[model samples]
Target: MARVLEVQGVSKRFLGLKALQGVTLHLEEGEILAVIGPNGAGKSTLLNVISGLLRPDAGRVLFLGRDVTPLPPEARTHLGLGRAFQIPTPLPELTVRENLLVGALFGRPGRSRKEAEAMVEAVLELTGLAAKAEAPAGELTLLEDKRLELARALATGPKVLLLDEVMAGLRPKEAQEAVDLVRRIRDAGVSVLFIEHLMPVVRALADRVVVLDYGEVIAEGPYEQVAREERVREAYLGRRA
Candidate 1:
């Protein structure tokens, strides 16, 4: 598969605090690349930079061979880039289906509302939310909310999905279900770059892993290679990687 997302020599700073330092990474099309790092390791910062929520101080972001460092999040989304948050955000005033409709409408770059609605229905079923189509978005359970977040992003019809710790704070079974959902998403040919602290999930779902520490990539490769790296083990033990 071709490279779908690329971060080269990326750096970000806030006043005197350096949030990221020369961070470079790439996400291939239709692959799951799990990013694991301890607190203060700039994992979330990387996501924000890629999604255009935060501008990096230096370096470039390329999508489909196009320079997108300056593009806004919506522009990127229109080009098949999508992101999910640690906390799912849904419109309390809207029905679950309505929320999905919004995604469907936006997912297609220049598609019509009717087309978006048709697409939304398909996405709802894929995200396992078809049964709650008429339910109020505000009434969803935690699992449903997380699924909704993913559903919203999927509604954008992305080829690449950036997830930020969406698996945290769940029971073992719930976590397993969430992991299964992610795998299913990947199976549908959407590349995933997920920021997760849970090693088991990372091990189970990711074909590759990227380990970051102090804003720089400390290790990158297959799960076993990265998990067994001395530096990775040290980094994990250093700040709980």
Candidate 2:
């Protein structure tokens, strides 16, 4: 299968700090890949670069076989890339439905209002936020907020979804629900690349896992295989001990 997203020899720096160095990874269509590492391992930076929040000091970002290294975030969205932030930041005054509508209407330029509205309905249903469609976004519970964040991203009709710790604040049950939703999303033909801290979530969701330490990939394989790696244990899992 062709890669849905690719990061080739990517590097980024902040003054004297090397946030990332020669990072390389790829996401295959309809697959779910997880990126795991210790804090400050450049997981977020990789997502930002892929989503166009920051351009790499070196390397290329390819989306669907096209070089999108120079494209802006909105431009990338139009080309079928979607991202959900770690923090769910919903528009305070807007209704849940409206929040998704904003993404549907503006995420892909030239989408008709009618088309966006239809998309909003579909997304709300998919994310299980249909019951709260008319509620104020700011009034939602943390679980709902996370759902809304994911729904808004889906509203963009992306071929690949970049998720940043969407399960962070949820309870075990809630996290399971989120996991199920993500599985359904992947089943519906979208590729996913996510940064996650919870090992259980990563194990349950990732088809493949990539471990990063000090800004570089240390291991890439099935969860059990990568989990048993000595370096992965030393750099990340052991710290949880």
Candidate 3:
């Protein structure tokens, strides 16, 4: 399988704080890769760098083999990198379908209104939001909000999707539904790189896992294999005194 996304020796700093240091990872075509870590482990920072929300202090971000380190978020999206935030914040005034239309139209430059509407309809169906397409975004339940967030990103017609803890606040059942939805997304040809705090979600969805600690990668491999690593254990649970 070809690599869809790559982060080479990426690092970031916020004043004196090192948010990430020489972090490296890759997402393969049609694969679901999860980035996991304890708090302050630079997982979010890495996602920001990959999605073009923040420029790394050093290193490169490659999307479909093209260096996109200098591109802005919209440019990256246009280049087939789409992202869904950890928090679902849809526009309250607009209907759910309209919210997705915004993404489809603007996510890729030069997309026509007809093309955007068609994309929105497809996303609405894929995300199980077609029934509520005309409902106000603010009136959605938690699960609906989450679906809208994921749907909006999908409307961009991304080759690789970057999801930032989209399963964070869901119940176990709801998360399972999300896991299934993501699988369908992948089957539809989107490679996924997601940040997840829910271990079960990672175990259920990720084909591979990357663990970050102290702003650096501590382990990378199959979920069960990485789960048993001593370093990974220490990252989440303090070492025995």
Candidate 4:
């Protein structure tokens, strides 16, 4: 499969503390890749760098075979990069459909109102929010809020999507639903790269797993293989893999 995203020796720092150090990974076309690590392992930092929310002090980021290291979040979105935050930050005043419309209209440049509306409708259906299209975003349950976050990202018509711990607060059943939704999104041709702490969700959804510890990658492979690594076990001691 084609490489849709690449991070080469990426590094970041804050007041001499290394948030990320020589980190590297890639997301292949149509694949679901998971980044797992203990808290403060720089997983969110990696996502921020990829989405252009933060610039890396070193190395580069490439998207769709072009270097996007210098691009801002909006520019990256125009180039087929979509991002959903860990915390769902929907506009409280807007309905579900309206919230999605924000992404559709601005995600890419040169889109007409008609095109954006059509995209919003499709995303609402895709993310299982069609029935709640008119509901206020702030009034939805946690599951519904998550769906809206994912839906808003999809409305951008991305070729690659970055999801930051979308299942952090969900129950097991709700997380399963999210896992299925992510698979459907990948099947629809959007490659996914996500940061997740939920091991079950990672096991169920990831085609490949990258383990990060102390701001560096310690293991990268299929779920079963990575789960067996000693460093991964030590880093996540007493936690079932």
Scored by lDDT, the top model is 2
Residue-level error in angstroms, candidate 4, position 36: 0.4
Which residue pairs show backbone clashes in model 1? 236-241
Residue 203 accuracy (lDDT) in model 4: 93
Q: Give the Å error, residue 198, model 4.
A: 0.9
lDDT of each: 0.89, 0.94, 0.94, 0.93
Q: Can you write out model 3's per-residue Cα lDDT over 96-145, one digit (the tens) per residue? A: 99999999998898999999999998898889999999999999998999
Question: Which regions of candidate 4 deviate over 4 angstroms?
Answer: 238-241
Tens-place lDDT digits, model 2, residues 1-241: 8899999999999899898999999999999999999999999999999999999999999999999999999999999999999988889899999999999998998999999999999898899999999999999998899899999999999999999999997899999999999999999899999999988999999999999888999999999999999999899656567
**Model 1 C-alpha lDDT per residue in residues 144-167, reported as the tens digit of each score:** 888888889988888899999888
| TM-score of every prediction relative to native | 0.96, 0.98, 0.97, 0.97
Q: What are the runs in model 2 whose C-alpha is more than 4 Å off?
A: 237-241
- Backbone collision tally, model 4: 0
Error of 1 at 11 (Å): 0.2
Q: Write model 4 residue lDDT over 97-179, tens digit each, in one string.
A: 99999999999999999999999988887788999999999899989998899899999999999999999899999999899
Q: Candidate 4: what lDDT? A: 0.93
Alpha-carbon RMSD to native, per candidate: 1.4, 1.0, 1.4, 1.7
Residue pairs with backbone atoms closer than 3 Å in model 3 (clashes) = none
